[model samples]
Structures are given as structure tokens and as C-alpha cells.
Target: MEGQLDHHPTPLGNWLEDLFAKLFYQPDDEICKKAMKEEMSPQLKVCINGQHVPREGFDQVITEARRTYNISVQNSRELLASPDATDKGIGSVAHIQTFTLEDKKTGNQRKQTSLTISVIAFSDGGKQLIELVEIVLDH
Candidate 1:
């Protein structure tokens, strides 16, 4: 997919864009920590393919994964996105993003695309935070 940055029209859109961009450039522990502390809600949960990751383990799983794979964004496309469409200050996005993952030890690299959908809701202070994330690898 041809990488494009012309679709972020809302806070959720911008958040998704920023998330990928951060990983593309950094792909480090800092990004993972930042995502967990600043972006993901304390109650946040993630579903990868069919595996479920509860809030208690979300940070550890993600942090370990980030450390394991040197991932860089190759391209991204928004399949569907919305801004507060439900009048409950809720936003959602469905996207397909391509990334290049390199193994640190083996020095092997491959490109993979994943279909991801994320739900965002406004916090009490009016900041948008990711509440749920679902991703299907090799999609």
C-alpha cells in the first residue's frame, strides 16, 4: 500500500497516525511506555489476531514485542474512521497498515500488513485515549 497521510480528519484519526509514525521512527521502549502511559487507558485491552490480552498484561506484552521486533511502518491506509459519531464522545477506526519487522538476533526482515481497529473515548479531562484495540496480522 502507498503510504498516505491525507486522511486524519479527527482526533482519533490523528492519534492513529501519530501512533504509527512514532513506532516507525522510534520503535523503542520509550514509544511503548509513552503509548501505555499517555495514550492507552488504564482499562485498555488489546486483541491480537484471536489472542486476548487483558489490561493487566497489555503493557508487558506490547513492551516485550517492541523489544523483540524492530518494526517500521512502510505504509498505511484508513479503511474506516469516524469522530464522535455516537454522540457519546466515542470514535473508532479500521485501518490496514504495513510494517517492516526485523529480527534483532537473526537479522532477518519481512514486511507484513495488519488489519486493525481501535476504539477511542474521551477522558474526563477531554483527552482522547485508546480503550480497545483489535488487530489481525497478515491481513
Candidate 2:
């Protein structure tokens, strides 16, 4: 489905947007680390391009991102939500992200890639903690 940015009225939507903002735009590693530790569940699962990424590898991912690419988040919006009978809910968020590869030695910008990311988030504990995150990249 095509993704559009809009103000989502639900609490879960607000939280998801805030998470994305801190993760993609904010450059502070400490803030990012705290957010991950506080917002993610102990059994959190993350996937990218249909491949599962170990929880322990998340720090590496962030480090790689900071070292390898200059990222800009064009937009992030909530697409849909599926709430269970309890407080758990699953939300789909769309992110328009642009990544430009950086040359390590020359500090030159290399290839630029713009993609839409469909993020599926499984939220529990009153939608405060994310238990699962599946990211699908669209070119």
C-alpha cells in the first residue's frame, strides 16, 4: 500500500512516530541506546529484507549506519493498526528514508538510495514496548 504521512490520533501511533524520529534523525548514540533499551522488549525480534537480525547485533547495525551512510528521514507515518483483545497491538509504519553512501577516506558522497520502508511493530505493555519489528525495504 502507498504510504502517506498524517497525524495519527492514537497513542500507539504517536509512540511509533517518536521512536522513528529518535532512531533515524537524532544522531546521539546515547539517546538511541537508551531508547532501545527502554522501549524494546527482552525478546525483541528485528528483521530486514526478510532476514532475522539478532538482538545482540542491533548495536552493530547502529554503528554501521553511523559509519557508512548519511541518512535522512523524509517522512514517517502510521499506516494501520491491528489491536488484539488485550492491550497488545500491531502497527504498520511507513518511512521515506534516503541513504547516501560515504567514502571513508575522501569523505565524499557516493551513491544515494531512496527507499520506502514498511515497518511492522508488535507492541505490548500498553503499547510501550516493541516486541517485534519487521522492516521491508522498497526501492
Which candidate should be chosen as best, given lDDT against the real structure?
1
How many steric clashes between backbone atoms does each model show? 0, 0
- Per-residue CA lDDT of model 1 for 1-139, tens digit only, reads 3784566445466666686565344756677576657666777667777788887787676666577778777887776777463344368877787888788889888878788788877664544455555564553
TM-score of each: 0.75, 0.61
lDDT value, residue 2 of candidate 1: 79
lDDT of 2 by residue, 1-139 (tens): 3574444435555666576556545778777777777676656666665677787786578667766655555544444444531144445433333444455557776443332333335545433443445444434
Residue 134's C-alpha lDDT in candidate 1?
57
Model 1 steric clash pairs: none
Worst window of 10 by summed lDDT in candidate 2 = 111-120
Candidate 2 segments exceeding 4 Å error: 1-9, 84-129, 133-138
- lDDT of all predictions, in order shown? 0.67, 0.54
How far off is residue 36 in model 1, in Å? 1.2
